[model samples]
Target: MYTDSATYNALLDGFCKCGQIDEAFMLFKSFRDDGFKVGIRGFSCMIDGLIRSKRIGEAEKLFQKVFDVGLVPDLILYSIMIRGLSESRRLEDATNMFRDMIGKGIVPDTQCYNMLIKGFCDVGLLDEARSLKLEISQHDQFPNTCTYTILICGLCRNGLLGEAQQIFNDMEKLGCSPSAVTFNALIDGLCKDGKLEEAHLMLYKMEIGKNPSLFLRLSQSADPILDSASLQKMVENFVDSGLILKAYKLLMQLADSGVVPNINTYNTLINGMCRAGQVNRALRLSEELQLKGHFPDSVTYSTLIEGLQRVDREGDAYKLFEQMTENGCKPNSSVYKTLLSWSCRRRKTTVAFGIWLKYLRSLAGHDGEALKLTEEFFQKGDMEKALRSLLEMESKLADFDSAPYSIWLVGLCQADRVEEALKTFSILEEFNVVVSAPGCVKLIHALCSGGKLDKAVDIFLYTMEKGYRLMPRVCNSVLQVLLDSKDNTILAFELLDKMKSMGYDLNSYLHRRTKSLLQHHYSLRKMENVAAR
Candidate 1:
């Protein structure tokens, strides 16, 4: 029953630190009710916890309480209040508090200034942020790595790459070593601004370590440097910019530097090559990376498999997929989806079915323990326990349910089993499971192929309603199917109109076919009417 002030303070601090703000406040209230004095540390903990929990209004109220209790807010308390306000985007209130602190002869440290600068930058007040950065020096506190990085990131976000780079240069000139975050920000800005070469060069400089003289020489030198993470990002940027060849050359140069690219770097290059339609080159790179002691990850194999499928090299893709599994790299949902989509698209129903079966088998191991428990309970004649075990198995199996069903649905559609796929799809819909876009595409294709125009249109409309963008191929297929019959010309026109309203691009061939079909339908209708008369 005898609690000391330090004990109460410790209890309050612990509760606040663990995100139990309510409990901390209750303790504070209890101590106050017991005529015990709660110090500024207790108040600081409460305020910080409230702010962190996003209860900014409550934090503000507690802060005002500090003054009501006749306690002069110290620099630490002021810093906490200022930071909370800044983070809450109440920049004006934060600035006023900051000024009040300064009026009390409290100089802001680098961290305090950085927080304010970050707040300004977050709201696109770059001018104000820069002014604050200057004020840090006026306070005789040099901006640290974090301060420079924040400004760089802010400038990059605002598309002020030039200003950002200048700050980066100034940061280095002031003997502040730029961190990985700083380099990443500047490099990301360069990449986004279509300055791939400069991004690459910057990455090279980053890898050579932080020597000013070396940075200068590297700028003019053709020698490549290696930083796995940053270089991996730059490789992606290059590929995105259609500079695959340049990215490849950079990778080759990195290889010559005796620094092997990581699996991620190889994956990026492999993905880029695949997207560029150089599947052969991508396959070769896969082999090359493996020879260099970097085996293909799930991502590498998935990217390569998808690429091969795009080029109609299903056999090679399937082989690579098997290799992926054989090499102890598990095929992810993406791999299964890719294989299913291609098999369905190409009408290789058997192949699609096999892939789906394999996916199901892969998931079988996940619920093995639960299944064993269920079997054991059943053997023991404990029906209640067996039922509970079965429920556990069901819950575990639910996690793997949606994806496999979508895959199987695609396979079913490919086998011309439209009704069954639709039934499965409806069950998914009831459970709020969204079929993948490819699954939608395959279903529509199968419906169109089966001359189920009404059903195809229904699926097409539903797919779009679900915000799934079907490929243009499926769109064209639906149109062609409708246009194949003179009777469905009006339906084709209506679907085209719907597609246009939905912002689907209408290719010229589709336009020509629709117009020709419309003309023929109208002419035939006109002739039929005349004959009737």
Candidate 2:
């Protein structure tokens, strides 16, 4: 019953316009099977569909098929193909297509010229696009609202807001009112440029103008490429500037406007409230986001846990931690680390060990638990228990390393346990991780404090041989230790000279005091010699 080529072409065009490219192709194959030839319009329709769906490669292949079919495409087909190529940002190809059409004596209409001009402008070829526009106007043909909209959007996207505004004014002078598509594009551009006040003013104008048409325009335009992103930046500025009510009003507006708030938007608002120490407000926002179909993800819970822990709200933090897990969110290793760090800071050794055991048992029975517990004990200043914890778990944790072992060694050296400290050092060397600079410096200071200068010298020499850079604080602590011993006073100055050569600026007062003490001791010896004479 479908006997005409134009009828089938119309049907194919309808399919392609509705995004049914595959179905359109199927009908084309049926036409070929029935010995009915296809025209350039049907083929161009399929190409348009491919381009709309971002299948540029397939569109190109179909473009070549049109030529292979031995039918010269008309201006309509060329326009559709140019629109596809331009929208895909194939500016050069779109230009070539236009030139090819012109060479074939097919003069471009408004649609063809607009498509290529927009392509050139979108890619920042403003001069070329302007030249094309001027040529079209010289021919007594005027550009449409869509043509001005494209140029304005291109200018705005390229951050030429001033130029974009001029074009916008020109559009208004031409009595061409901006559609919702045009307004949305400008709003997005303004928001990205941080022109929030302007965006707000535009939104206000749209609302008060009773233009339900604009709302429909925005809703029906291509799904927004901007939503909730500007909400985050606005919330941050409002919080920093103490505009809490403004932030709250913006959030409500976004909700009413059907803009989906992203995770970053929720986090920004919640964390800003917490940073302001408005914990109650922060907690309420967390509940609000969750109730609005966005569950607090890992980052959200972690931020709340950290904020509560920082303010000594451990009971509240623990309750939230448990609730997070009950809500089907698994607590990560970072959560356990935060709790352990909090316990250590509060000097709750028992609580720290309990958390460590819980973390280990959760992963069955692993020796990592022992290493973590030993570090906790050392951090809480329980060296004996720390060393004991490591030793008891040594066989199971054979491959484990603990900072507590080095911490215990320093404690032993402070207790005058020379042989025990040496044994600890030997155990450390066997583990293949050399003593850290802080560990070595702590051990040297402990030895010097206990009047064991020889052992301290040996440890310092060993540290140098290992190539560890001594911190200025550690160097100062060591020199103070030597000053107490009153034996290595000369060596301390030699160390100071070395530190200076290594670019460390020792305190002028401390250096002068050390020199004065040395001079006084030399004068005492001279006085003793003179008295004997």
Candidate 3:
């Protein structure tokens, strides 16, 4: 093979294109050593290969050598140098090189402009990136899909979601169809911002391939642009945001679009529906999912069972638990805990005991240690020791859930250990355990009965602050205790006003009693004033 300068340049170009940078570099060095004058074309190939290999310093030296060799760099060489510098995060150097390219009468194309914009965006210089995007149009070059997508992605990453959305809308108006990457970035931003409805609508548009105008009307619009998305994640966001109905509707749309949701998605919807007090709707959804061949997993069963129990449908919950076992979906520790906690709260002693037995049977030997300590402490009437042992076992075994701690708090309150119960409640709170509403109410009432009026008021206020719904009787009892005390009448009135702000209605008896007490207090004050006069 009689290799000449042209043949050497061809080999270099081929090696660089194929990512054989070392081979390309060695061939270039050998060609130079053989006294073959390397043309600007050969230098461009070598520089591009060095840049691709992340050897920016070496590439810059080669680029400088082109000027020393008295060869004015062409647009191809300048473009390669600018792209290399921009990608290496040397934005200033890239910008200077870009200006130099123009100074030498070499006009840049849209691709060159896009490279600079991406560099700006990569470093969160969104304002600069946006400016470069505008510059593209001024240079008689329209911003392409790549350009807009880069800017949108950068804006979204910087939490400028509103601007990102506007850019997306503009991209659509200009007839640039958004790619999957663009949609994913925008959807993810919306989800993170808690804009569940917007995220859902955007995801629907992406999956269904509807045009902007038609999507606004949600009718038959543009051609279908089918793209894959994190549909389950969007459902989760909807559920987490308390948009249960919206999540349900999203699920329906997903199904209509021939996108099959997994059982996890159904389970999330069921949990959200149950929490929103739409237990009946949740059950219907369960049936719908089952019909669609998405059988309920243990999570689905546990969520529905808890939802049923929440609505006071204990029999339905029990039946579902049996169905879960029959379906071969072994109820997990969570399911057993749910049954045990609810049974104990409802004072179904036999049911709770049975559930506890089943829970123990379901666990391996060591996993049941904390529960056994709970049982032993309860049997010996040692609530403190029981709680202590449970905590110790939890630190060692890490198998105890919030259920056993809640049961102990309720039991302590029921046993009239109000002080101990309060301390236990505080410990539970420190551990981020949510005590049941019934347990809170019982503790509050017990505190009132024990002549701990201030403590009782504090507990009541704490529960109210946490958004726990208590019976009117609890409020009335606290108000009665406050009004009965000479020093706490003002507190009673303040509590009444606070309750009003919280949307609680005072019963007629308390209202009348408050009025009578105020009048009586005024009458006594008037008698004292007369005596002083």
Candidate 4:
């Protein structure tokens, strides 16, 4: 019985105006399915609801769907979409739609022009706003008081106070008396321009309060009951009191009143949702952001991932991480580091390795292709090809990091390609890349085995001076090299002394063998010397 046009519009208006979207949409669907004539107001209410909820993409689709159902857009509908689009920062789209509306012979009222001009002014496009003002003035269309205030506000904000003052003076000459808002605009402009005395004089002449928000306040001409700032303040109070749902509703009311919240506001709400253990709700907000042509950044995705993990939904977290990359929002170090730790805590080896590779790739500046190729070639026992690819890739990299270089040196050592390893070491040194302890050991061992004992000793000396971590294996390997060369007896003794100082068990088999070799050489030299005597 209440599904009649008057009741339907009233219910939908009440629902949409107060931010009851779920019930509004439900009723909208039921009204249609029940064969009631859902008039133009139905579409208008739904679109307004979506826009206020920041579901701009869905609102756009609903508008098209209305047209597809054989309905044409009238002035009110066109004005709504234009206002929605312009307020959402799609200025060009709003302008193009305005042109389309005009081509169809629908004359835009002053309200429509005011919306676009306000949009232009908001984005600091004063020149474009002035031109539009001129065009409208030349036509039969008259600029309202709001239009003049918008231009004056924009000019003053852009630091063109002289022009703003001229526009303020012209307001009276053009037959539109300055409202309190108009005077406030000029006074605020003067104060912002460091003309406090002038601003005080203006305020005194206007007989308004010294405080701006307290007196000379501007109310929406169409809806003079509550201003957007009051609505926003109400929402803030609700949010501060931990009434998230209520705060969200009031925020929507502000949006319905034509004040779009900024990105920081959306982030705040999403973060609050996650903290309140409403992870799924936060995830839904992420989808709404995307639907509005706004992609979630690393923080957005990371918050949701952490929330999902807390709720024991690791699988969902991984999927979101993958989806985040697919959407082209690059992850920062904190994101991968968090994910890597998450994988480790879960004892998921594959996940940890995958995240580690991703982390390294991020550090490599999106050079995943080259990095993967180099690692793959090294794993496949193709040392020459790996070295070639690494060199080629290095030519294009503006910055050098240690991970890729360590992988190259490890591959070279494993394949016994000692010469190329030395050249790569030189390149790393030239760029001041700090190879890890494992990498230093691998290269030194390779050099000694390739009959480059002196080269190995030189690296060992440098590693010692640089305080590189010398594993027992590194000392053992250097000792073996020195023991094999009779002329290096003194160096071997010195290395053993250093090892003893570093808490190495000098009584180990390798150390004993080294000592035995040196003692045997000394005895042979003494016997030869006695025979000569």
Candidate 5:
């Protein structure tokens, strides 16, 4: 009584194309379970739907199901399948499947080829990617503007400016006048390469002519859409590249465009001003934003507080912190971190500890780690009393995720208790807490200084295997111990060579000092040989 299967499948396919993924899947499932004839198109539509929804694994399962049901995967099907795999970084499987498709006499379409080439470029396989482009050109269907743009952008992103520009030049020789997209890509590449003047020149040309939305278009959704927003982003890019006047002009443009500056927008401007050491202008903007009914948020206060702290205005920072709370805005982790950092800089340990405790005690639900950390800090002076308080809190709300592993690790390291630090490090592994490189470095450095060189070296090797970069200070400490003997000195050199091979420059001051000492030993040996002669 209902429309035929093709008609229904067509309707479902349309639904998928329009982003109604849930509805399409439901319809497809209903068609299958009800014994309706679901053809290759139906299967492909469902697979495409799943891929578009970012359900790549599910799409892969569906593709296998299609093969199991004896449906020959078509070009569109293979293209979509390859796309899903490529986007998820399963490039090897994608390449194999694509080759298999070619063997089946199903030559890939332009989009499919582009997808594979782009995937290779994404993972920095530039030479292989260029080969694909050459293949496309030989086939008399050289990739389109989008394909060239993607390749250029990818090459530029990988810092292969020479290759990127060569591709662009090839495009020109091919008689393809550069579009707005091409221009934007080049400008962005220039910006990345610190050629702000060139980027600005390109941007200036766009202003005098098309004023294309390509730059804004390149930015994905969740990015600001309006002209002002795009201009603001451009300003941010320039500012990040140390182009202050460029940012200022763009900020003024936002005002001229009648875009009402919100708290965040104002905060950004004030932060820029504060960074330039124009505290008076930043504060003036803060008051201006407030008068315009856009009151300063915690960030605004934090920014000013940081500025005050920078200029030795600790009293002013405290006042701003109090004012922020009075304005019904609670301080964030950053605010307390900044305050404590300032206190530490001024050697005000008591003030730092006070701020730390206030930040710790303010925690409630989902703050077990902070509370436990506070307990550990208090433990050094009063362990029995602190443990009792911590145990009581643990009884009420205990979550394994919020255990004081990091806190105890830090506390143990600070107390110079190597045994306890190692124990805490092991305990952290038991809790599945990811200890960062800095945390491990601090511990290893402390252990090395305490003559626990073997233990420290073990930890450093483990950290290195885990792809963690050791701090120079920690590496130097380990190197010092390893260079105490001739055999150890050779081992130290081997380790340094390994580090260099891993892309760490061993030309650091500490590394050079160790090298000089080793060289001195070699000179002493040569001098001894001459004396014997």
Candidate 6:
């Protein structure tokens, strides 16, 4: 089964793949000495291995050797050479090789197009990548599903989620089905953009849209029919597993086809409707659920409560709250937290505090204890304790942004934990968190007071870069610190000029003092120069 040439080629390729170039060349020389015609496969293998090893120069030279000798390379060789160049980020070389393929009358295929497009995308040349898509269309080759998936993923990675979605829609319209990887790109993009709710919806779609029952799942296959019992069992399984979104979609489809949904299916639909902020739809579904003998449970009431709160229907929320209690459904901490948060959002701090107080003793040694402890510690100036309590809260709620991280920043400053304070501020900035200017200023002042002027300057410059202007009073205090603690008078004077440019009008006394201090500094410098002379 193995000719000597075939065996030698395989061995050479294995050496190249493993980056053993010297042995591969020795084998190549052995082939040449044995009078075998130069193998294109051996050349392609070496090119790829060199590229993978980041030795693009050597690959390029080998490519030139093949090209210069007018060796008629096959499609695999051409594709391999182009891929190596693309992966090496040598875009121009890849382009030339692409052209060379055409000039050599070798017809390029979809993989070649994909490689070039992916190369452009990797280098942030999206317009070029799109232009190639149009070029491919001009060649009368419509993009396949992989092409669309590649473009969609590339656009999303570049923060062009809208464009990615447009392409995704185009893919669907063109009869190109989306794979899990394609959907995940958009989900990941939404998460990166901090659109957590949108991300959740996409996840809902991925889960429920794709995980249909047997008949529905097989609708695209050769046999698309199932018995009534099988369909009912499928719906029941979806409902049992809490796949509410899928169950709701399937139930609605079933309704259109004259099959009324069961109670469990209706409840699932109602819950999904509430979560999607279609509270009115949920209400209608609730009425229909009861008509179907599906009594609303505690989950239904809780979902409705949240839905009502989301829509700012506080009066209706309370009415439902009373209704749930009268029906003997005990209110849980989640329900109370939702109520307290809504009340607090409405500026009813007193009512919110009342709600918290009412629940405090009931939730002893539970999650609610952290919120209570944070409140108590903050009010009592026990910032360290407050910060720890907040960390505990964050451990449970991934999207927790109850208070500005600036609160802990101020506490860290007051505790003279300068390094910790700066690190915390950096974390807040990295997340694009809106910190209070007063708290940042407090940190700066604390640093200045501690005579860590260099660190203070770092924070000041960082804040200025973030568009937070330094207060005139703070500037004056920093200037005082600079004059007293640091010997860099030129930097002090530069700061004075910056203050003037920023329109921070100094008081008359501080004005005279700064001018007088600068004059004295200059005179002292001049005297030192004369003494050296």
Model 3's lDDT to the true fold?
Answer: 0.77
> Taking the tens digit of each residue's C-alpha lDDT, what string does model 2 give over 173-253?
887777666777788888999999998987776667553454355446564324576557667778778676567656755
Query: RMSD (Cα, Å) of candidate 2?
Result: 27.4
Tens digit per residue, CA lDDT, model 1, 1-533 = 45676787778766664455665776788567545788888888888877765688999899999989988788788888888899989999999999989998998899999889999999999999989988898888988999989999999999999989998888878989987789999999999999999999999989787443542443345543445765677688788897998898778756645455799888888887776557778888988987888778889989988877655667888899889989999998789878887776666655664565456457645566666665677567554455345444543453544555566677788678787777767766655667888788778877777778888888888877888776544566677678787677778878878878887766532445556666787788899999999
Whole-model Cα lDDT of every candidate shown, in order:
0.77, 0.70, 0.77, 0.71, 0.70, 0.69
Worst 10 residues of 4 by lDDT: 209-218
Q: Please list the Cα RMSD from the true structure of every candidate, rounded to 1 decimal place.
A: 25.6, 27.4, 29.4, 27.2, 23.8, 23.3
Can you tell me which runs of candidate 6 are displaced by over 4 Å?
Answer: 68-70, 208-533
lDDT of 6 by residue, 304-421 (tens): 8877765556898899889988988777766777787666445454455456445544544546656777778867866555556655555455555534355446656655767767
Off-target runs (Cα >4 Å) in candidate 1 are 1-226, 258-260, 368-407, 430-432, 436-445, 448-451, 464-533
lDDT string for model 4 (322-395, tens) is 99889897877556655655554454433444554556566645566887997787667665566566656664
Judge candidate 6 at residue 413 and give its lDDT. Answer: 67
What are the clash counts of all predictions, listed in order? 0, 0, 1, 0, 0, 0
Please give me the total number of clashing residue pairs in predicted model 4: 0
Clashing pairs in 2: none
Residue-wise lDDT of candidate 5 within 435-481, one digit each (tens)?
Answer: 66756875787776787766776677668777987656567657867
| TM-score per model over all chains | 0.43, 0.41, 0.40, 0.41, 0.42, 0.39
What TM-score quantifies how close candidate 5 is to the native fold? Answer: 0.42
lDDT of 4: 0.71
Local lDDT at 310 for model 3: 54
